[model samples]
Target chain A: MSRHQVRVLVVLALAAYPALYHLLTQSPVGVEAETLLPRMDTMVALLYFGLFAVSFDFISGYTGYLSFGHAAFYGTGAYFVVLVANGKIPLVPSGTPFMITLLCAGLVAALLAVGIGLVSFRLSGVYFAMITLGFAQVLYVFVRGLEWISSNPRDGASVSGSTHPEGFEVGVPFVDGLNLAIGPLSGDTVTLLGHTLGTNAVSFYLVGAVVLACYLAMQRIIHSPFGQVMVAIRDNEERAEAIGYDTFRYKMGAFVTSGFFAGVAGGLFAGFRRSVTPENTFYFLVTGDALLASIIGGFGTLAGPIFGHFFDESIREFLSPAGQGGGLLPYLQTRLSEGVLSAEVGGLTVEGFIEAALNGHASLYVGIVFVLFVLYVPNGLVGAARDRLGGPVTEKLPDRLWDR
Target chain B: MTAVADPALADAGLALADATPGSVFAASVLQTGFFAGLAEFLRPSNLAGVLVNGLAKSALFVMIAAGLSLIFGLLGVLNFAHGSLTMIGAYLGGLVMVVLVGGATGAWARLGYFLVALVVVFAALAVLGLVVEVGLIRQLYDSPPIYQILLTFGVTLVLEELVRIVVSFYGLQPISDWQEALGTKPAFLARQTTLGPVTVRGLALFEILLGALTVVGIWLFLTRTRYGLFIRAGSEDDEMAAALGIDVRRVFTVVFALGSALAGIAGALLMWDPVWGASVPLAAETLLPAFVVVIIGGLGTFRGTVVGAVIVGMADAVTTWWFVNVVTWTWLPEVTVFLILVGMLVVRPQGLYGVEEVGGH
Candidate 1:
């Protein structure tokens, strides 16, 4: 197949994922009261995170610059949107349209990224990582200190304001009645094609559309001539410089571009959750999550991290509690507690043992899986598939995935 | 070292000297008011307290960073689990304190029990290091640095969760119970003691002494032992050392063990103080400052590690003091370390003592 055919197929696949997942998990009951709604919600959330992971791969996978501070940009975008919506910013009025605020947030993040890149890109390898981390730390502290940003009005500014309280509406302009239901919204359900859809399901389509656009734009950028220069810089900066390309400028541009998309992802996240916080948006662990997704998906593949996160989120959801839509662990816990199995095992209650062994430890298993991947499947699943398929699949995969 | 000789100090002195009669009168009035706070802050005891605290903190950073530096130098592997090792040591020490030392009646007996626990902690971590090296790390010896980093990071997460699960299983909460169980009665370490114009805490003094001993001991071991020579040789060129019949694999194992032992000992000692006791979040939190220490001191250099730790610790201490007292910018102190790190990277990426790396990327 030609390259263009593969690109179109990838886009079609991307568009099909949410619809297919929604349909596959659909229940006989209306979607509003359906048990599968939570699962759909998770998949929709995965798309936004996939965008974040893709942005992360742009700098890290292509440039070989592992940014331990990419969360700085993500957090910037999140805070920007929420702060504007809250009427905290002087320039933007409160209850402004979500799209305008999101764009402004992306712009702010892009500008900040350029400044950070100028200072950080000077150092390479581990030093670059440390400095970027340091920059993020600075921002984290700075934001945490702001009394106005995180305080409750009742208890005054001293009350923790890590999460914004009053949720904002995300809606289309000129559409008076249809506010996009991005969360566990109340009231009536929207119906399409005689199928009832809950607020979260509607929000899923909205977020999925945004995520698709962002991914296409990013993929186009990665395949452009500018992307060629970025890959060149990543491979050999000195050689790229020797060729009179002004490597620093190229790097700075890539960094800003990455920051802008990361911001967009962050904005989507804030809108979906209807809240943003330093812990959620700005933490180094957020960057770590993106890094994990990119590595597992196949770094530099652009589209691979999307699937990587899908796998990750699905596993975590499966491991979650029953009320939260988990299956295996929760089922086992219920059976043990109900005396469906022997409570006593070597004088230890089976239920208690299960709780002790598995309660809140799913992330630990994820970490272990990450290590195993790094050690054995360094090129990730995409590369592994190409290798196993030998010829046909290899030819169809992105050039960057197999280029090295 | 003279106040007048320092350019900034000279400028300040000149400004004071240039004060007009009216300004002098105003200064005298202000001295009793705004200047009073400054004068009290400059008191010898207060200044000594800050430096002592700074030294104690630096000692902790140095201990953790020393282990990290040693591992990185010897194996070219940046072990992200170094913090996890330290945290495990702390938890084990806490158990020893609660289970063993709790049974002791006398202060002397308790002290002896604590000392024994430190050795046990070191031994346990050494064994852990051996297992980790042989079972997991050995397989990735020829892998890229990123793989080593990711593997160690995975170890860190797993170890942190394990610590959490184990601590909870023991029916103990972090900070309060762990600290009460681990520390000695009379709580001498946590209490401040005054000596004439200087004031210091017992734990701070102990930590400083321990830090000094650790640095000296490592130096002597490197300069005076056969194993140390082999480690240095292997670190320089593992293939060459192997060719020379140095048993490089054994050296690598020993190096990892030694590094973990240092972390274990540090963790055990830190348990002496109630404030810095090992907690799960600590394993993750310590990773950055440890890296900052390694980078600022010049990676893989022992002297550089010590210097870097001291600098970072001092900056933290001074900033905390200033922010709390002088400016009241509460958030600024927490970030001062990162600012210093960024500044250092921008000015000198090789660090103060590091040789310029050829084709560094």
Candidate 2:
């Protein structure tokens, strides 16, 4: 398929996800779809992460400058949005519009990127990587000490008007009709297309739309002429400089762009999570998640990390405990106990094996898969597919993954 | 290590060495105002405690950093999983110690068991090192340097999760028991020995001695042994060394194993000393500091690693001692280390002992 076709297909699919998920989850006869289909809230959360990873891919993937402290922008955005929305910031009063707060969050993150990039861009390679990490840690400590933001410094402030107190009600953008009543808001049901949808189901569509918009914007940036310069710098900085490209300025631009999108994702995350802590917001490991997603999806492919994150979250959902409901492991365990697989292998059932593997070591499998991927499949899932097909059919997508 | 690496560093080291404690202290007060409130904040007893504590901390950093430096110098890979290896060693060592001495009758018997367990842990890590090199690392030597980092990172994740899974599955009580015993201030390591006005724990002194011994052992091996020559030569010019009828590949394997073993010993000592008790997060937490030490000291240089460790370790100790007492800024300790790390990178990106690589320095 051509690049345009694939992008259109992806956007259409994302747009249809809520309806498809709703329908697919509904099982035959008496079986409830709730168990089989992930909860709407879960889907929304996955979309948030998908967006986050996609933004991460925009800079690190294109420029090959692995920002180990990317979470600094993420936390800044999350904290800013939540604080502004909750009337914590003096200038930004309480009940500020969510979209405005979100935009402001992105702007703040971009400003932060400029300051950090100016100092850190001087170092290259591993030194650059460590310095970014150090910068993030400094931010992490700073937020952890601010007790006024939240009553507890360690556990940071939450959106006061979130789902808990009904201090705010989220509705369709620009539409006067009351939508998903969150926190202590309103009625549980939202009527759409002659069907009454739960608040979570409405939330899924709302967040999904935002995520789709962000992804498209990032995709546009990735294909722009400026992005090409960023890629050139990644491949060879000296050559880029020799060509009179002003590689440093181009890199700074890419960094700011990446930060802005990452901040948007952070704003969405705050909305979904309703709370933000230093550990959850600014931790270095959060950047690792984006890196992991980019690697798993395909570095330098703008949309690959989004797909990677979705795949990751789905797998995690499948293996999670029974209380979550509809977990594949629990279902497998039940089936194995009733079937012949339980009797084989000297009495240790397939269920036991699965249990053993999933017993707090799910990440081990991810690590093993990562190593194997690096060794055997450097291009990741998307790149390998592209290569096998002899590259993208789209003229817009060059033979290379990074090429627009 | 090699003609003093950088003369400026050598001069600074010598000058600092030549300065008397009183003079240095007075200068610090005058110049940086670093010791302005020292009289109010630190008593004689507190000073002794911080010094002894700092020495022990430096010892730990040195042990971990030395192995990391050796591997990076020889293999040209950062070995992100180095901390995980140490973590594994600590867990294994802790388990063996508990099994061997958990049932021992007397203090002497327990001491013997502990010693035996440490040796066992070292050997185990060496064997693990061999397996990792032969099976995984060897294939990636020709790949991009990032592959090595990613590979080691994956290995670290796998090992960390594996440790967690194994402990949960096997109901590994020794792991938790060791933590608990250490938390309660175990009788075995509770006693302190007073030397000249400074009271120091026997375990701390032993760890310090071990650190010193590792330095000497590694220095001798590097300077006097044939294998060490191969390692040094390989690091400098692998192709050239290979052309000269030397099995550079075998040298890499040996050096990697030895480095891993050294990390294992450090991990085992940490378990006994209860410094950040062995846990799943140990691998993740120890990684940055080790990276900082290697970078600050100069990549692949033992002397640089030692210097970096001291710089980091003493900064941590002094910051903790001062901030915890005077301002109660618990967060300053981490900030101090980060400041040093950033300052070093901005001033000397090649590190104190390293030659230039990326050209900034």
Candidate 3:
């Protein structure tokens, strides 16, 4: 198969996921599939958040400048979208199309990146991370206290019923026929052929489309000559400078571009969820999640973080407290005999042990996996795959298999 | 200054302030303005209160940040799990206090038990630190500095989740202050005492005392002991220290243990304070400020940490005062702390005493 064939295959697989999930969950093997696979709603979250993580990797992994305050851009994008919809922002009408707001969010975040990069790019390594973090934290605190955003800003702002109550759309700015509203309840549903897609399924496709676009854009940049300089700067800043490349401008450009996509991701999040909080959007741990995704997926790979987040969200859903996605505890409860569950070990019943060890404790397992990856799988999943292929996977894998 | 010293001048100043504005003007601007707040802040009583509060905060800052600074100085690894370790210390300290202290126990005996709790927490966390350093951190010594950070960050996730499980299993709210632990505090420490014009919490005074003692103890360890000399030497140039036949690796292990021990002790202290009681989220809350303090002081310098703590503590106290009395913005104090960090980085990226290339490594 060719590289383009592989690309097409991947996109087709992603596009088919919701339909496949629907089909598999209702088949004779439904129970097993339901127990293992992530729910459609979780997949929707995975798409936008995966985009944020990919953007994080774009600058941090590619340029070797960890944008530790990357959440600031995400939070700005989210807040801008919500605020504009609520008519809180000046000049921009609340009736402004959702796509326009999202684009504006990206632009605003890109502008913010320029402002932050001006000061931040002066420092490198840990100092750069710390300064960016400081700036984000400053914004985080400011937003949390600003009553102008809401009656209770600490709780965050929501898309109010007074304005834009139908939900944010995710297509062309003015074309209603092309646009699809995205939310759990407020979203639009579609019936295609004999299959009827629910709100969540529709949202999954729409959000996935946006994420795919962002990914392709980032992938193009990574494969460009500009991206070569970014990698060069990461590998050796002095050498890049010696070769007459103005490393700082390239760094700033990369930062702004990543910031734009991160903002878009945030806007998508706000559009789907219809609410934004400082804790979820601007907090340092949000950046940590992106970092985790980048590390697990393959730090420098453009498409790696998405797969990384898929792994993350799957684990989280599998160990979720309520077992909303049919997790291990529920699966065990259905599979285990009464006597086996009641059997005692280490002063606790078998059921009790599982509850104590596995239930709602996905973070523990995820953390362990992350540590192991850092230690043994330092190159990450995609990077390791590339290593096995003896070069970039897209270019080398095809040659190894077909050309030979 | 004159208004603070002389009653007549103060009265005259008040009269002039009262005469200057309409009631509407006073309500809208003068009552909430910076100048009015500044005048009130300058009063001797308010000054004294803020001073004590600032000192207490500085003490806590110093205690939390000292270990982080020390470990980074030698290992060049910013221990992200330090705050989680401190959180564990709070719980362990609280556990010791809750188990040992009874309703009938006197304040002096409670104080003694608190000391015992501190020692127990320090020892336990030191052992844990030893295990982590030897098992996890040691393996990443060959990798880039970022790996160590990533490793410690993973450790934080595991530690916090484990704590959450235990805390919840024990029928306690992991997010809120553990009231049972707060109940273990001695009566004297829980109450307020007036010193002339200033009123201060007994816990604040105790914190200041413990903080000073900790500072003095670490200072003596660094300046007077052979191990301290080795640590200082190792921090400067570990390769050179190794060439001189000093066990640099052993020094790293020891400093890591010591740093963890300091975090534990700080957590134990925080457990007794009402403002920051034993809680899971305390890890991030304490961690961020500790980061700011360390960064503002320069990443790995002890003296700079102390100076940075004082600056941050004073700023926090002042902002808090303004929030309570002058400004209605609830995030003023918290925002000011981060702003200081940003301002400091822009002005002097190396920090007060940091070498320019310290973070580069």
Per-residue C-alpha lDDT of model 1 across residues A1-404, encoded as one tens digit per residue = 45566667766775565566566555443332232223666866887888889898888888878887999998888888777766778988765667677788889999999899999998887667778888997887767655567453111121113433333344565475755546554213578799777666676667777787788887778879889989998788889899999888888889999999999898888777666767777878788788778777787667778867876776566555445664455556543457754568887776666566555666677778877888788867775665775633435465546454
Fraction of reference contacts reproduced per prediction? Answer: 0.61, 0.49, 0.69
Q: Top model by TM-score, which number?
A: 3
Candidate 3, residues A1-404, lDDT tens digits: the string is: 47776678778988899989999999988887888999988889999999999999999999999899999999999999999999988989999988889999999999999999999988887888888998898889888877788888878999998888887898987887899999888999999997889999999999988888889999999999999999999999999999999999999999999999999999999999999999999999999999999889999888789889999999998888855768887887788898999899868898887787788889999999999999999888999999999887777877887779
Candidate 1 C-alpha lDDT tens digits along B70-163: 8887787878899888888887887787777553467767768788888899899999999989888989988656667778877887787777
Report residue A92 deviation for candidate 1 (angstroms). 1.9
Candidate 3 residue-wise lDDT at B229: 97
lDDT (Cα, tens digit) per residue for candidate 2, span A1-404: 44576677677887677677667766352133443556566677777777778878787778877788899999998898778766778776655656667778889999999988988888787677778888888788767755456767678888775523442334553454644433212325667789877766666667777778888787777778987888888898899999999988998898998899889888878866777999888988788777777788887787778767776666666667555666666555554456754655766676666676673355777778777877888777887776776764343344344543
Model 3 per-residue lDDT tens digits across residues B1-361: 0001111112212322332221221242344477877888798987887888789889999999999999988899988999999999999999999999999999899989999999999999999999999999999988877788889999999999999989887889999988888988889888777789777788878989999999999999998999999998988888999999999999999999999999999999999876888999999888888989999999878888999999998888877766555555666788889889988888898899887767563
Q: State the lDDT of candidate 2 residue by residue for B47-74, as single tens digits.
A: 6666776777788889878888999888
Chain A TM-score, candidate 2?
A: 0.87
Off by over 4 Å in 2: A29-38, A161-164, A167-189, A333-353, A393-404, B1-37, B172-188, B358-361
Which residue pairs show backbone clashes in model 3? none
- What TM-score would chain A of each candidate receive against the reference chain A? 0.85, 0.87, 0.97
Question: For model 1, what is the C-alpha lDDT against the true structure?
Answer: 0.72
Off-target runs (Cα >4 Å) in candidate 3 are A401-404, B1-32
